[model samples]
Target: MAAEAKQSSYDGSHVENFEFYLQCSGEHESILHFLMKHLPEEFERIGADKSGLAVLGVGSGGGEVDVQMLSLMQSTLSALPITADIVEGSTELVAKFKGLVTKTDHLQKIPFTWHTMLSEEYMQKTKGRGDVKTFDFIHMIQMLYYVDDLTETIKFYHSLLNKNGRLMIIIESANSGWDTLWRTFSKELCNEILPVYRSSSDVLASLKSLGLKYEEHFIPNTFDITECFDPNSKTGQHLISFMTGRENFYQSFTPRVRADILNVLRSKCSTEKEGKVSFNSEMRCVFVYA
Candidate 1:
């Protein structure tokens, strides 16, 4: 008989950090201002009279952040009556998001579709549809780390939007105190135990060098994850995928050395300085018009 693969090995409880991270990184306003780039005073503009607008959310993982954002966006666009669609790579997440929307009375009124698709596939379809400049607000939140081609990605969003439509790409700033501290605090741990994702700013610069005209914002959000590391939480299971490249990622140390590093890092990370445990993050919000 074939060896059974381990089930329930991945924990994603840290996803709860999405809300806290959004606050620490200041992503809350980025989405709203993203809409305003084209429609001056976007918060005040989304009314019934305006042509129903469409917003596309790319890489809307687990739809947790989207849930928080949607609440804020919903009330903001209560005036525009915009239709929003989310592009997610995970089917389970899509179902979860739909459930969240259905359960929430306020969200039920928002006309939204969840496209269970990857960014590349969605972009291909968007291009094949020949709908150049079709979106009013396109957003890529905390998803750029997976892409190798950031410029092409941004251009694709730009192509899919109408002249006045805007695309918002949110990335964490490498220079923020929160990020700086995390890197410093977790350097030994990260270098040995986890695979690091590329920074979003690198991609932003790549787009700018290509001569793309875009506006940007700095928003901060914080997260408290002491319990996420608890042995009892499913959140720890979420590390399986993130650990895919562990062997190479931990290449800097011997196996035993790496293990030691992980233990130390976890202890330090879980340490609380005061009544609450917290870390800050900076999100860079970029807006480019169609």
Candidate 2:
């Protein structure tokens, strides 16, 4: 029988690990480029004739992406007043986000409300209230993997959008390395108790099933995973842990399981050339309109 190792989502305790993962993943650059090239038109479509906007960031981590998106929105909308609500589960990440906001002078003009809670909790709290606040823009970036119910979560967020509002979701593409890894080893690596290992393909399927209209765009990205093949590398181990959503994966998983995972990662999820492995970290963004 396979050994049953403990599993948990990233939080304050694993903030460093998550940050390291982000640094190695090349995801930030891909997302930023996509936003810079495409978001102005999106903002124009959604913000036309509007003097004010309510924006929500779900699972916003460290606020780097949030700040960039908000800055673009401000520039595109020029004179519009924007209010941002951030929902993040990690205390450490929330503190980092707050600190980033404090240092950003342009963001100082915009009001931000922080909710240090998970998206599910925030959704429940809002739904339970006598008066529910609607939003003009909502972005859930690379965060749906932690949700309990993907379909229900999409439905809830969609319901919160005002007419002409936009709900943007970014996740791993169906053809990305993440999708390949999770599809191959979900039974071995994914936590059975918590939601994890989902990709953009799953999100699109849900949106279609719910009778929602959405547009999808692909962002191609690649990252070096040569370190991941080296068992002695601490950075490699952290990257592996992040990929598997299992802390200390190299130390915790059985030797057989670990070896199998490494084999799959190298041969299936990434390309190796000249002794270097490049992971196909492509991502997809889905835009749904209300």
Candidate 3:
């Protein structure tokens, strides 16, 4: 059973904490690989030259994408200057990312640094100091929602970018079939649903208003509900991840709503003959000039 959702300011630490969703996911790594390819295209558009680029990973949870991007950056810029700073918003994830770099074998490929701060606070501080033009690339991966103002964040990074620097953002695509189903059935399912800061459509419109253009791409993810009931093949990972998240936001719900949510989740996750169980996550790669 879970408690109600907590009614607190979005913690800076939730970035990496949220990565649990992907970590427990079976098809997450492949989507990550796809994001790398999409990212460079934007980097090139901003005239990065793919060499010696100083990159910032804003809200870089768990340093997963930062590590992958830095590796790709190293390969692309062997002769040029290549340094990366992964800025995390979560305390635990910041620690996890640092630990990962020191502990991971392949981390030696790229030179990198780590910092942790809320995107909004960091932007405010960076602005106050005029230390804005420090990065050639900044990635706000699934993080802008935590901040109260999207325009301020957009403007902040827009200023921080060096000449031809690029800003890339990644967020869940809310217009997918899974999202549709989640919204429709979630009320009946009694399963816990986490809140998203921006809907897919809203984010798209916001980016568009900034005069920044983006290419839409998706990394398909699935919660293989069928695997859940099979104790032999039981991936307790999904259940645990879902359950844990429910635990955090659980307190926000009333007992009656909570039970209804979980009940529907179990049935929806049941292995029926025509069990359609794939949630498509759309990742939009937004690119702007330096």
Candidate 4:
């Protein structure tokens, strides 16, 4: 029922709109709040003393969120030397992130190593190196959707954590608007190049099955997706492609399917009030302790 051999829209062409989508979604603010609230206390409990923190950023896109996270952690652990290992695959994004870091003064306080590879590749590299490093905190923010084996990926990252270290993750909650879009269009529009979409609920179930105890927090988010209703709009088409993980998803769909998808977007996936269409963009943050 799904499309065969379609490339994901997360490439360079779609990155701009995807960043816009993230801007409107308010996911970043929620994540910042979670970090500010939990990290200080968590660091304290983990015995913040002589040795500084070692952090890992998995799927760190454009490094914006990575910078924010490190900034806050720096504030909490004032004058504490920190080492960061950044794992990202996109050359352009990593360049942009590094550029941003160069301009920021506080970010320079935390020295970092850049790994231009996927998380699995980084894991294999580390294995080859023989456990030379252990992370005090590892974050996989809105990135697990790229990995094929979620449970194994989780375990691998968890194994990288030092004792009392934390692995934080963020993902869309099930039955939210994002989930609705994927579930509705998956039969015809699903992209094989992308990993199967898994929501926070699915992740929690997987963790439970593995006998892992974790803390969960819900982040209430919403975005105005009115542009998606107009098939002629470039941003709209880009968003459709992003949601379905297909390139030119609007163009790929039959005229009837396109219309139906729009109708469902307006009626089911979004709420219309004051002539503004807002999508249910709730997300969840899960914390697993080592």
Candidate 5:
């Protein structure tokens, strides 16, 4: 079942896609800024309580960002202890992150409970086993694309938070290149079993429907994907694969569809700024309280 899930899922097994996307995108810098602005307040709250904080990281690929957040918390809170529940669907990713934990001196200090499973699978296991663990902070960083049901998953996680707990989600902003690309692909190819691509607007609407109050911040970014102008370039292909969640979008889609997609990407999805073909993305950060 795990093998089947990985095969059909666009994100769980796309380690290369994730890596390529990370290389091209300045998302980490934006996230770092967001964290620096907000984490101090979170640390103050946790410190005042004087109790160990609990964290849940969904789709925590390679633990790079997770460790960053923890490191920030440590520095800001003066080494307040934390118990983190790390949830990742990809076995390869989980192993890579575990390797980091073993080798990285800083990551060694924070305690972690690893769940090598999808968010949905983890939720099911918890429900079946009657586990009622509540986390003070939870995060799903740029990972909603893989989930089958966005609203339900958000609600479920919200329910698992203790009082004053927070759920932080990062996703592409509406009308951005990433948003345009994913919405088009989803309209063309989404199905009951496959992943559905959605933007931060979709998530915000869901929260609104649930009558939940939330906060949002936009992180502006640009990636120079000029190489993608040449459709045959390796970088172009890699960027397409990462954007479309396909191994080889040109080979997988019909010529007409692929051409249309390329046209959208080269035009509607990008702009020339400072003489460089830049993919403009506004990543939205949503914070929900329980």
Candidate 6:
């Protein structure tokens, strides 16, 4: 029998690897730029008639990006009281987020309710309840790939928005190397139990199918994947594992399988220039309105 393929979530033991991948890929810079350029105007419009703004961060890992977003909202609507609800599944990430909040004085002013649970669980608990909270702004960034049902999850989040509210989602774009990689090796690398092999294209399709109004923006980005080709580099291995959504993938897969993946990555997923490989890490930001 063949070995069972397993998918692992980022936790204390492996979250550092994910962070390293982020640093190498420079995805956060693009995300920050997009939010800075777009979120302030939206915040102004959303808080125009409201005394306060309610925000939700779904799968808000470590809260670094979340804080930046909240700060922008504060600056845009200086007098509007802002409260946030955070839903994250990782306990380690939740602790780190809490610690970050304590260190940042501005974030301290905003009241936050933390739920150390998955977005699905949070949705289940709040959906159909009479007193369920609604939000003026909600963000689900780079976290939809792990959800069980992309369409249903998007629908649930869309339903949580108040009038004129927006749900911002960031994910890998259709033109990204991730789309090529997953299309080529989903059976080997993707999570079979969940809809993990998803990209912004899928999100758009789901939005259109559900007849939801949304605006899409593409952010062009690249990843320095030179380390990924180095067989003996621990960082390289971690990057590969993070990209594939598999823990310790270099050690877990057979040598033949690993070689095939590497070949595909080099030939089909990245471009070579001056002996360095640059993987296309383009991202898309979608704003769904209620």
Quote each prediction's TM-score: 0.64, 0.94, 0.72, 0.90, 0.89, 0.93
lDDT of 3 by residue, 1-290 (tens): 11112213224433333444555555347557676667555545544454467778887666766777766655554565666777665566777678778876666655776666666666667667744547887877666544567776777777677777877766556654334434644443233223433545656687678777455556555554544333344354334334334333344556576555445445442223565433333444455555
Best by lDDT: 2
Better of 1 and 5 by lDDT: 5
Off by over 4 Å in 6: 1-9, 192-196
Better of 1 and 5 by TM-score: 5
For candidate 5, lDDT tens digit of each residue in 84-158?
899987777788888988887876878889998888898888888766898888999877766778889999999
Write down the RMSD of all candidates, one decimal each.
Answer: 7.7, 3.3, 5.5, 3.2, 3.4, 3.4
Weakest ten-residue segment in model 1 by summed lDDT = 1-10
Against the reference, the lDDT scores of all candidates come to 0.55, 0.83, 0.56, 0.76, 0.76, 0.82
Pairs clashing in candidate 6? none
Candidate 1 is scored at a TM of 0.64
Give me candidate 5's TM-score against the actual structure: 0.89
Q: Is candidate 1 or 4 superior in TM-score?
A: 4
- Residue-wise lDDT of candidate 2 within 1-290, one digit each (tens)? 01111112445546776667778877788899999999999888888888799999998878989999998998889889999999987777788899988998999999999998888899899989999889999999888877788999999999999878999999888967888888788777666643357788789889999999999999899889898888789888778877776778877789999898889889988999999999888888899989
Q: Which ten residues in a row have the lowest lDDT in candidate 2?
A: 1-10
Model 4 backbone overlap count: 0
Q: Which stretches of candidate 1 lie over 4 Å from their true place?
A: 1-49, 131-133, 176-196, 222-280
Residues 32-100, model 1: lDDT tens digits: 454344344543333334556677888776566566666776666655566778887666567777888
- Which consecutive 10 residues in model 3 have the weakest lDDT in total? 1-10
Q: Candidate 4 — worst ten consecutive residues by lDDT sum? A: 1-10
The parts of candidate 5 lying over 4 Å away from their true place are 1-13, 189-195
Candidate of highest TM-score: 2
Which tens-of-lDDT digit does each residue in 1-290 have in candidate 4? 01112112344765665675566566677767767777777766654553688999988878877887788777777766889999887776778889999999988777879988877788788878854688899998887766778888998898888887889888888888878877777676554555466788778987888888799988777777888777688777666666655668766778898788778878988899988899887788898988
